[model samples]
Target: MSSLWEYANPLKFMRTTDWLLPIVAVAAVVVTTTGLIWGFFFTPDDFRQGSTVKIVFLHVPAALMAINAWLMMLVASLVWLIRRHHVSALAARAAAPVGAVMTVIGLITGAVWGQPMWGTWWAWDPRLTSFLILFLFYLGYIAMWSAIDDPDTGADLTAVLCLVGSVFAVLSRYAANFWNQGLHQGASLSVAPGTRMDWAYKAPLYTCMVGFGLIFLALVLTGTRTEIRARRMKALAARERMA
Candidate 1:
């Protein structure tokens, strides 16, 4: 447990991720390409939705990452607040943009899917509404971090914001279940006895999910490394001025 905190050192974290980043990047490219190609070309179209179902290949994974990214940030925030870990705070900072991009992808793909299926581009349904709220939270988190000049103060404020925003993020995830009447469908991937998706779609969908997860990991690592370097540069500049 004590050893784990050693990674909170920025220089150590940068050195470790240097090798890791390229591996993750290559894996992300290969897996994402394979999954998207397989899902798009090989998978059978849905009898009900037809080719529009192909959009699911992008939507589901993005939505999953969108929610999971916030969860990751929330956990990182807690770690920073409790342990005063610089790496944890920077990790939370690094994850925000990736999460925001994922949220945008989810929202846009969902709108595309909705237009064909629900006959409207946008709906005020509980699921959609909550997701929008989640996006707003992401925006607010990013903005809060940028608004403050002091790194420590920014970290503290954003960590608290991340904590508070987590409640809404949980609510967003369960909104579909809570409001069954919403136009949005239920879980597409489940391990339950009776699953809605067939293996034909499920296989590639899972693959894409894995691919997106890897992509998220790669992006976070790269962003965290960049943040570390920027902080180091800032510290050096401060010292030079003091001299």
Candidate 2:
């Protein structure tokens, strides 16, 4: 356990991420570019939805990351609370904007797809409403962090908010299934036999999902590094003032 905690040391964390970032960044660029191009051009249009169906390549992946990013933050927050790990707290902080961006992308793409399929750009459907709520949670989490000047205090406040918001996030994920009447379609990918999405659409979509996840990791690592540098600068400035 103590050895595992060694990774929480800022110097160790920075040394590891310095090497890992470039590789993750390159992979994110290559894989995401490939997946987006393949999905947009190579894949056939849906019989019913036509060209607009291509938006799923963007929408679904962003939506998946939107939820997963918050989940990641929640876990990071828990680690910070339990272990007093600075890296974990900063990781949760670094993830907020990325998650917010993903949520916005998901919502925008969803709206665009909906206009053609559902005959409206916006609705109070369960899925849409829950997702909006999730976005608001992201905003709130970010706001809470910014509102507090003390880093530790900010982390504590936001971590509590994240824990509370997680309930709603989980609700957002299962809302469509529970309601069963939303215009939004059900899950595209599944593990059960014969229920999975067709490979024609699924292949590029899954690739994009992986790419998005990698991109999220890359962004978090970059942002966490920046936070660490800023904290070090602040501490140095304080020490200089004392001297």
Candidate 3:
């Protein structure tokens, strides 16, 4: 009957993660390797895009995570703002770099995919533009946290920044649907049977998505543990200096 919030304690969180991190990390590696092998090798090429279509396994997953990681941070930021949980704040901080990397991967892969298809490497497409802006917001969020010395104050400011950046996150996900003029296609793995991917492509794509999600979870856990230890060390150093 212990409440979930009990894990908010730094010591408890560390203990839980110590056991949990390795499992998630190993699963991430196994699943990601399996999905990539299945996707890149076993799968046949698309009739139109040919070999380039394989890139979707990576691009789609990264793009999805890029937006999802921001959503995770937004939720964590809210928890910190309302509950004043240090762990929540640190989790949000940890996710920024991961989310930023996902955004970069999405952008790069999209450009690579677009060059032949769209006759250009870049475009002012609404989704692409909004995704780029989300990346910038990630950078600003990370920088704002580093610039402020007080953890609580920094968390407060960054929480507000997260709220602001969420607008772009929403736009990034739905801009293609809103503006039909864009080069980007609709969801590759939609629930609608008509729009969903073929079984050959969809199967491995789903696997890759799960793998990427596991990888993100493992990374955030690792980052949160490091941040917690660093905070502990800093507090100890300050106490020694005061003594």
Candidate 4:
């Protein structure tokens, strides 16, 4: 257990993360492949919406993760800000892009699905507007990271931005609750009298979420490792300059 726990420290983490990369990568591939094949082929069509509704399996989960990922970064950033943990800071940085990608996926998929179901593809409905705000938060967070010259300063700015973003995510999730009406129907799976999803659809939806999550973990680790290496190289070069 002690040996296992040491991996939290940067030095020990360096020794272990590379070994786990292949394992996580393989799991991501297997889950994604199986989930997509089953979801695309075997899942039953929606009674009302028909085939277009299939996009929900992808869109809903990605939207869920996008919001959740920013929350994760908020927590990680808080820890980094308070405790000054390098790994936590790196993790916050790495998670930003993944969350942004997931947000884009959700928005694009939702738009595509809406065209056939709703008369128009776009609407300034509460849910849609709040989600757009959430997407902008992701962009702002990424931009803060890139704008600063000192990486530590960038981390601090982005951490504060992440905290603010978490607040927005909460607002986004609840925006529908506040509104008198919504373009989105209450979730079938998540709400009361939950969706009657067939087993085939349920299985793949969960598998895909798991697959995407693993992919996120793998990418975060890879980015952290690279950040560490880059820092080390910079330090060594500085030492040579001094020598």
Candidate 5:
């Protein structure tokens, strides 16, 4: 536990990420590119959905990261509130835009995929609606952070907002199950041996998922380091003024 908390220090965090960031970035690029090429070009067209099925390579991973990123922020918010760790708050802030971008990717890909199947570009489906609301929450969280002058105060308020928004995040994932009447389909990836997706699709899909996760990690680490550096510069400027 103590070792884990050591990363909360800005210098230590920066040091650790210095070596880790490039590896994650390179892995993300390689894995995502491979999965996309494999899924799009090499795979057979679905008998029903045809080539449109290839969009799942982008949609599923983006949707998964969209939700998971918020969960990551929620955990960070809790850590900041409990431990007063500035790094945690900065990390949550860093994650918001990444989550928002993932949400947009999910929404756009979903719309593109749905048009051929659902005959419409948009729907008020349970899962889609909740995911949209999650996007709004991400925007709101970012706005709230920027609106305040004091960093700590902003972090506190945003943490509360994160707690409130978590309800929608939960609903976003399970809303289809609870409502039982929605245009959205069930999860594409599953642990069962005989899952809905064939191994051909599942294998590349899994690769994409891992790639997206690493991409998210790399972005957050980069963003958090930027924030830490900015904070340090501000502190130094203040010291210079005092001197």
Candidate 6:
């Protein structure tokens, strides 16, 4: 934690992350491309859902990240709240757009897939409704960040907002328990041993997921760097004014 805190300064962050971004960027592109090819061509059509099921390659990972990104922000927000770490606040802010993007992807893909299978593009089903609220919450959080003026004020406000948002993530899970009506089936890719593996499908799905994860990392790092620079400019301007 102390080591992380030491790199909170903009200069430190820029210096440390400078060399790594390009490497990650290239890897992300390659992985995503490979995944798409494998998913679209190599993976066999599902026996039950047919070709539309390929959307799972996109939908599942985005949905997983949508929820996990908030959890990441929640942890960063907690760090900021408890220890007053500016980088933690900046990181929480940085994560907002990525999470929002993931949520949007999940919503759109889910709708597209749902229409053909369920005969409706939308549903009041618990899983669908809960995920929708998650999307809305992402919008609201980003809106709040944009609305505020001062960085510290924005960070504090958004930190509180992120904290509030974390509670609702439960909807992602509780949607199943509360309503007992869900459009989504239970997980097909279970981790338990002896779980059936169709190598062709699993190969592409895992590749896409890895690719998406890399892309997400790249986005978060870039966003954090931007926030750090913006803060520095603000500080320098204030110092000039004071001097």
Please, what are the lDDT tens digits per residue for candidate 3 over residues 83-168? 99999999999999999999999999999999998899998998989999999999999999999987789999999999999999
lDDT of 1 at 166: 87
In the order shown, what is each candidate's alpha-carbon RMSD?
A: 1.3, 1.5, 1.1, 2.2, 1.4, 2.0
Stretches off by above 4 angstroms in model 4 are 2-8, 191-196, 241-243
> In model 6, how large is the Cα lDDT of residue 174?
60
**Tens-digit per-residue lDDT, 79-131, candidate 2:** 99999899999999999999999999999999989888999999998888989
lDDT of 6: 0.83
lDDT sort, best first: 5, 3, 2, 1, 6, 4
TM-score of 3: 0.97
Q: What TM-score does candidate 4 get on C-alpha atoms?
A: 0.90
Residue-wise C-alpha lDDT for candidate 6, range 1-243, written one tens digit per residue: 457777767677788779988898889999989998889877788887799978988998788788888888999888888888888888888888998899899889988998989888888887777778887888888898889988878888888888777876777746676766667665557788876658778888889889888888888889999988888898999999999
For 14-83, candidate 1 gives per-residue lDDT tens digits of 8788798899999999999999999999988899999998899999999999999999999999999998
Q: How many backbone clashes does candidate 1 have?
A: 0
Q: Each candidate's TM vs. the true structure?
A: 0.97, 0.96, 0.97, 0.90, 0.96, 0.92
lDDT over C-alpha atoms for residue 82 of model 2: 95
Task: Return the lDDT, model 5, position 146.
Answer: 86
Model 3 lDDT vs. the true structure? Answer: 0.92
Model 2 worst lDDT run, 10 consecutive residues: 1-10
Q: What's the lDDT for all of these models?
A: 0.91, 0.92, 0.92, 0.81, 0.93, 0.83
Best by the TM-score measure: 3
Clash list (residue pairs), candidate 2: none
lDDT per residue (tens digit) for residues 123-187 in model 5: 99999999999999999999998899778999999999999999988898889889998899877
List ranges where model 1 is wrong by over 4 Å. Answer: none
lDDT of 4 by residue, 65-124 (tens): 888888889888998899887778877888888889998998898899999899778799
